[model samples]
Target: MSTDGSAESRPAIDSPERIELVHVGRTLQSLQHLRVVAASLIVLYHTELQITRLTDGIHQHSLGFGAAGTDLFFAIGGFVLVYTSHNRKDTLGAFLYRRFARIAPLYWLFTFLMLGILLVAPSYLLTTKGDFWHFLLSLVFIPYPHPVLGIDRPFLFPGWVLNHFAFFYLLFGSLLFLTSGKRVFAVSAVLCALVVLKALFRDQSHLLNFYGATVALDFVLGMIVAWIFLARNETPWIIAAVFLVGVSIFATGVLQNVSEGAERALFWGLADAALLFVCVSIEKQWGWPECRLLSKLGDASYSVFVSHLFALALVASILRGLRLFPTLGVPGARIVFLGAAWALGMVVYAAIERPLMRCIDRQRRPRMARMIVAKGP
Candidate 1:
């Protein structure tokens, strides 16, 4: 019953520890479907933009409140990266290269595509200031000066998550160098310090001031959860209880809003931290619920997320053609619009993104091969 074998291994053998005879496809698919659901939550958060329709409240009405979904992503990223890294005996250079191939090319692809759309459909652009250079700088994650939304503005508003991701890669990718025990403690320490600093210093200002660090810490929380379950072979329900407690804190309003002197930010961060723990624990205990189509959608979850905001805009425009927006404040219209945006984004991922990623992979492998050859091993 040995499950431990390389992909290249054949003729499965028996052993007390190995479950090679067993299939885990159902669990895998279940998790994949959950990933798609998380992406949907983020999209739903964005659909509110059209609902509010505050023409003059750009910064005030900006998507700052949408981070609950992004936090889920950070948690998932951390858990998945740690799990995959445990199995990857490859070199750091190769690992980084592979990860970059996974994320960057498609990001640039959509970024440029959106820019093209903006040129043709100026109404879709977040800004008309024509600060092309600033936007270009932001392509490299450099914050543009003057306009708070300057170069980062777009037809789709979710691009900032990629900027967050670039920083995540820089930090989370570095954890490979640390011993597992040390990595977990270091990440926890950082998370703790952030809350303390917020309370004592900034009074819970935008956590993004140390944005890279905070997100990385959230990822670390995931990493620690992974390590615990991996080492113990069973997740503790106490961990689940902690998450429930965090939810209680949030519900009770103990952690409401920090800027005005409420202790809410501390509670919110703790709750999210607990959520990662709970999600990982649940996945371990009940296993993922099986679904084939949803898993495939989950496989495209990254692409779906990166483009959903833009997809919403595109869908909205098409509906606008029918003069739908003015009357569509009805709950049914909102639900239909959100559902349609989600579906269209999935289609785009299936039709465009999946193929584009394959192309990127093809391009990367040859380059990696060339580098390996140049090294002359």
Candidate 2:
């Protein structure tokens, strides 16, 4: 796939040419599959939260483990930024523009929608307030304490992740002036410095504290994995074993409830980096069967990640209003919620996200054509 997140032409996975092209550059289906998994895990985690809230803590099991999906996402983001940028000549403006265009439009739509909800029916919202400052800051991707929630969440809760991504993009994009090797080294060095500084000084400033978290290192881990991936070809069994080890470590972290600070980064972040490495490596060596539905879901994963909260809230409201939770029970209600969330996310992807992206691309294409004409062949 291209750095703009567009799929590229690929030879059939079973073909000899496809195996040869794996090293040259081919779409790793495994990453797409993992994207679906990461998005669904987040949806499930949030659904559990909603369920527990509605039931007043009556729900038994916890899907809090699913929160590690964020870790997985961070790692994947790092890997992708490096992997896609490989052997390409992308100007800094183009890199930042593509990243922003990919994430911002859908996020802005949801932010405004949340603001509308807060204005028209604040009761529908659980914690977010109708604060103009909070909404404004959110629009610009600035981290600020939410008025009611008192956390660094935006009007749209899922937008917090985008704020992190914004930071990562800025940090990464600035390095595009350098060679790819230097860019990687610079990003790794800068991220590590931030983490170390944060650990040493323990600054209280919200932005500093937020950016200083060890979670930033997940991206560094991802870059390292990408470097490894590009440097060597490993046996499928070796990659599979690495994958199992990653899963075991991740499962251990989840079971132990290691969900914060350096421990979370060390456990979930490292494990996810390993998992991503395995996925991309193994898929490159030995092809995966085409699953159109899952691939579609993977394409919509970003939409799902940002919009699932809205979907879950709507579903929960309907279920509660109809008094169906009693009849359906926790498990059945969760199933309904998960299914509805995915359906709504896919719809949003089809209806809003894709159109917005195409519109942006159309605008860019004309400008690009003009530039090309002016530059002359």
Candidate 3:
């Protein structure tokens, strides 16, 4: 759900004088569509879980793999950062500011909205209540134990992903202050080392445990993809083979009920990374057709992800009140819920998130222009 659909100029890695930086629009566009896809899958996963719970387990089938969308998200995030910044020069402060502006505004708005709801009608939250400290932690995108659920989640459940993203931004952005190409390796090593150390110590504390989780490796896999992309590597077949192997392993593990930790990260990360490579390669060579529906969805994906819990709650409450869910059954009710969530997200994006981003960009552009003018041609 991280959409950074912007053009940037970066020199090709080979033959420095012969190479020239150009805008890589097609890959960005493909990534936009992927963002929409990833967000939708997550929505479906959550919807399935909610519906199953509401129906008293009468709804049988599982959408367990839908959670893999989150792994793809982490990879996409790392790749986007490295790919976009490969050729362009950006200071740590500037990069951090852009990331913060992109993610925090809509997040804070929705967080406060959820907070207001908690204050006004806690029952509406439906078993996902937290104290003031949890609320504060959520605002800052920090990990904390949920008062009701006893999990490392906020009242707004999906916002837990933001905690990991915030940390990734902070760690990766800080490393950008180092010399060229060093940041990727350094960041990868640090992330991997942290996970290893965490595993060794068996620490389950909030911050360390969160950082040490296998999911963090997805970002590293993404960084590796960015490295490949930047280098213009032509090993798609090898990557594709690796992807197949990874998927096979992941599937077997899931079927056999043996998936966990490092195994999960390796298999899923390989598959996700391979997916990105293939997508980028295809789009770069063949081009993605411009689709208005996908573009809008991609633009609103962040809004959808951060705000869909509210939409889900609203939809479920209404369905429950009308006693429609049982009649609709799992599949039908899931479709309705997913559609409602997507529509509500689009509305929230159009009403608040889009305008706020535009306003901030409007203010930022003049300063950027002035700086460019001052620097001279």
Order by TM-score, highest first? 2, 3, 1
* Model 1 error, position 299 (Å): 1.9
Candidate 2 residue spans exceeding 4 A from truth: 1-25
Best to worst by lDDT, what's the order? Answer: 2, 3, 1
Runs in model 1 with CA error above 4 Å? 1-31, 54-66, 126-128, 145-156, 187-216, 233-240, 249-269, 325-328, 363-377
Worst lDDT 10-window in candidate 2: 11-20
Tens digits of per-residue lDDT, candidate 2, 163-273, equal: 888999999888877766778899999988988888877856777777878888888988888878877898878887888888898889877877556777888888888
Candidate 1 local lDDT, residue 369: 67
Looking at candidate 3, what is the lDDT of residue 196?
Answer: 88
How many clashes does each candidate structure show, in the order listed? 10, 0, 0
For residue 253, model 1's alpha carbon misses the true position, in angstroms, by 6.6
Better model by TM-score, 2 or 3?
2
The lDDT for every candidate, in the order shown, is 0.56, 0.78, 0.74
Kindly report the root-mean-square deviation of model 3 from the true structure over all alpha carbons.
5.7
User: lDDT: which is higher, 1 or 2?
Assistant: 2
Structural similarity to truth (TM-score) of each candidate: 0.74, 0.91, 0.87
Best by lDDT: 2
Could you tell which candidate, 1 or 3, scores higher by lDDT? 3
Q: Model 1: per-residue lDDT, tens digit, 201-292?
A: 65234433344234445566566766775576444668657767867855544334322123323443445556656655666677655566
